[model samples]
Target chain A: MRKFAALLYKDLLLLVRDKAGLLFLFAMPMVLVLVMTGIQDGAVENSSKKTVSVLILDKDRDEMGREIISELQRQDLFDVTLADSTQTASEVQQAVKEGSFLIGVYIPENISSMVRNEIESSLSEMLGLGSTPQTDTLSSLKVFIDPTVNNTFRTTMMCYLREASNHIEKKALLSTISETAQEFSPFPTDSMAPPPDLKPISIDEIAYSKDAFRTNINVTEHNVPAWTLFAIFFIVISLSGGIIKERQDGSFSRLMAMTCPYSTYLMSKIVVYECVCVLQFLLVMMMGKLLFPLVGLPVFSMHGAFALCLMIVFFCALAAIGIGLTLGTFASTHQQASVLGAVTVVVLSAVGGIWVPTFLMPPFLKAVSVLSPLNWGIEAFYNVILRDGGIRSVLPNCLLLLALTVACTAVSIVAKKKI
Target chain B: MATTILRIEKLRKTYPNGNKEVLTGLDLTIGQGEIYGFLGPNGAGKTTTVNILAGLLKQDSGNIEIFGKPVASDRKNTMRRVGFVPQSIAIYPELTAYENLSVFGSVYGISRPELTNRIGKLLDLFGLEKFRDKKAASFSGGMKRSLNLMVGILHNPDLLILDEPTVGIDVQSKVVILEYLKTLNSHGTTILYTSHDMEEAEHLCTRVGIIDGGKLVAADSPEALARRFPECHDLKSVYLELTGKELRTMED
Candidate 1:
């Protein structure tokens, strides 16, 4: 016990003395959290809660075109605006192309008349009357979308516009049919009010997890855990460099020659570095919860699962330390350890959904992401913070992280024997 | 003979992925209270022999007994009686001189009071008292070497192994280190030293063992080896006559 304490004390002293290293360890993650959340929050709002700007170039000066614009505004997804009268079709295209508005609708002149004529001709043919000749001019609604918009949002806006136009056409056709029936029938059409057109099926969205609390995945919630895990895993560079230095300087050999087993030195490193990892996590989390709101970002919350969230962080630290030990044991020099450790951490972060969310990745990448320890860490964090899940929910991810720690530590020990 | 402090019979080693054996059937013994100079050229299996005794390595085939207990069976307890000063400066540069000694002393299981006393005594003995609170990184090369030697002897092990402990230092520092080894020997500590400097070994070692090709070629006092090779005037001449003048390079 005394020997272990001595070893631990020595390592902690070294860490404390390296003021630059300590500052970088804590500050870099905080900066990443703030910068990443600030950048991603705008994107999150644009895709979900924030309204998309839509421009209307209504040339028809008719009821149909007006009704479509009104319908678009009524929906919560779009903020409709009237385009300048002097703006030509080319001007409208340039505006949309420049991303002044996410979408632009061009309602051609006489669109209402064209629809009515088509309806009359169809009705005349159906009633066995002689059909009127079709008009030579063709008028249709044209939509202009900004090229920069993501495909998913573009598809959604297109679907909504199509549905709005179709609904208006159906209403006009129904009114025409009703008027024709009133003219031919003996009974008055207004004797009794018609029932409202209520659809037979409606959809209600429910929370997918056990908790009924449906939360938005704001940037704060997403970035805090991701950057924290990144900072934690990046400890490999420092830890591995320390190991290589010890080996090169002969401190490792001197300790090995002593009666104190080399395992004590390794255990001391694990204990100290793991604590540093946890401290890094807490610092970044505090930055998100306290400092983010000051910068106009959402406050990061764990959904009241603080204890469970910390458990995941602890497991994440172990996994990180395991990798550091393995890297330090195998790498022959400080440069090799540092370069390889940094590259490995970056690759892991890339595949683990730290830089990009897994849901947005392709299926193959998402499948590969599950193999990364960072992915397991972020998933566990999401379960507790985003999904409002319980211990049972995060158990699988935590267990996987624990397994990684065991495998890496085992490999490090075997490698240390060879060293 | 005095009690055998360390004994090795038929020790052999070949590193993994290595084409040649580093040590082949090497045999040696050192008695208590003897300053034995184990001499060899570069890659003559000198450091390899010391590393095996220090338990930093395992022999492929050998019988090693330290203090009458098999080293293979009881490495932990056996190593408690050994101290190794590597050729390189091994002390942590970031740590203060006092802190370095305190740490190694504590790990050697010395009590806090005893450790403080020993650290103070060592700092004074090595003329490092003024730099005790300073970081080792700021020390000159000679001071760093002294601190390295001080760390090895912090626990005052029964068998002290020095591998070129004074190499690359000024003559004054070298003399101080060589003189300290004599003082340590007079206090009944068995010493196994390896170095390329022949004059220092001749003046310091009670007995000298000249090894080549993983085998000891001559074992006697320096005076006797010089007399046996009548044409050689000193230990260096005797060493050259026995080992040869051609430059040799081997890696362990």
Candidate 2:
């Protein structure tokens, strides 16, 4: 026991003296959290109020073409632009290709003539006057609508065109049919197929109201806090180098010569590393509370949040130390130990939802996350911060983390024996 | 003999590569209150013999008895009576001199109060009291050597094993270390020392063993070995006459 205390004291002294290393271990994570939050928050805000540009090619000089262009301008959904005659199809295609225009519409010529022909044909058919007239004028008129427009925009424009065509056709038919009826000396104008009467149709458009889709969730509130927990866990792996150093320096052999059991030495290391990790976790949390609010996250009751954080920190530290011990036992040099430790932490953290949200990952990847202790840590953080969970809510994650810690420690002990 | 503190019989160590034998049927016994000097040129297996005795390396076949108990049978029990100061500086540089001594003392199961007292005495004995608070990193080569020896003796084991304890220190520091070891031996502590300096070995060792090619060529008092050799007038002459003037270098 006295020997164990000595070991602990020695480790603490080494840590204290390494001021630069300590600062990096404790401060770097908080700095990363702050920087990451700022960037992500800005990006999310910018994406919510997205803008789409559109190019319009008006070929028809008629009133119908002008009305269509005006209708597009009245709607706020698109930033509309009129392309001049010199701006050929190639230029419009290039703009669309370059992503400058969300879409492009080309109005064809003779659209007015097609509308007049449709009115004459409909009135003549209704009055049974002259044989049914067929000429292909309507087909030419259909070409005036841009075929490249998206379905939503195209439908709106078609609706407007149809309304205008109905009004023009009705007025032309009413005047021509009534004048013919009077010249033919009819008993009443109604006798000539009701004088090809025109009826008015009501057109109503209900514009959709745009809602503010962007919310004010702070960067730290989303995932940075969880990543901070993961970073602390990674630092625990660096402590494995201490064990390798002891072994290389012959201190381990010297201690063994002093009648101390190998088990005692390993346990002492685990205890010291766990303590360091817990301290780091607490420091990061305090920094978060002081700094997170400055970045715009809502400040809530820190008591429950800190409690959940501590529980996760404890389990993560235990597991990380166990991993460190396992690596230390097998490594022959400090470099090898550091490499293995870093690789293990990175792979685990990546799978554990530290880098990518588990929700965004595929099912298999999410299933693989169960193998990572970091997953439980981040999940615990999410429960506290996002779900506003208390101890009862985070209990399962806490239990799993604890179980993992025990399992890793056991595995480390076994590996140490083999070494 | 005054109670044999360390006894080894038919110690054998063979490397796995080419089945090369490093220690071939060697045997020796060390008595209490005696300074036993193990001498050999480089690659003469002096370090291997010391390592085997210190329990740092396991021997292929050997029977080691420390304080009349078999070290091979129960190493932990036997190791409690022994303290090892390796040829290299094994103390932590990041820790202060006092802290290093305290840690090493505690490893032998010394209590907190006893460790504090032991550490203070060791620092004072090595003349490191003034620099006790400073880290070992700041210490000069000789200071580190002194602290290293101090840490090894902090627990006051029955047998202190030192491998080249004064290899790299200044003359003054070497004298201090040798005098300290002699003082400890006079107080009934057994010592096993390894060195290549013939003059120091002749002056300090009560029984000197000359080993060459992993074989014990001669074992006796330095005067006896000199007297036995016809042309030898000093320990160096005896060593040169027996082992020959050859530069021994290890291949692997």
Q: After superposition, how far is residue A297 of candidate 1 from its true place, in Å?
A: 2.2
- What's the lDDT for residue B164 in model 2? 92
Residue ranges of candidate 1 with Cα displaced over 4 Å: A42-59, A72-104, A113-138, A146-153, A180-186, A190-215
The number of clashing residue pairs in model 1 is 0
- Residue pairs of candidate 2 with colliding backbone atoms: A108-A144
DockQ of all candidates, in order? Answer: 0.81, 0.52
lDDT of 1 at A310: 88
Each prediction's TM-score versus the true structure? 0.92, 0.77
- lDDT: worst 10-residue window of model 2 chain A: A207-216
Q: lDDT by residue for model 2 over B33-64, one digit each (tens)?
A: 88999998887778888888876677888788
The lDDT per prediction is: 0.86, 0.75
Misplaced by over 4 Å in model 2 are A56-218, A297-305, A358-370, A387-419, B15-19, B72-74, B241-244
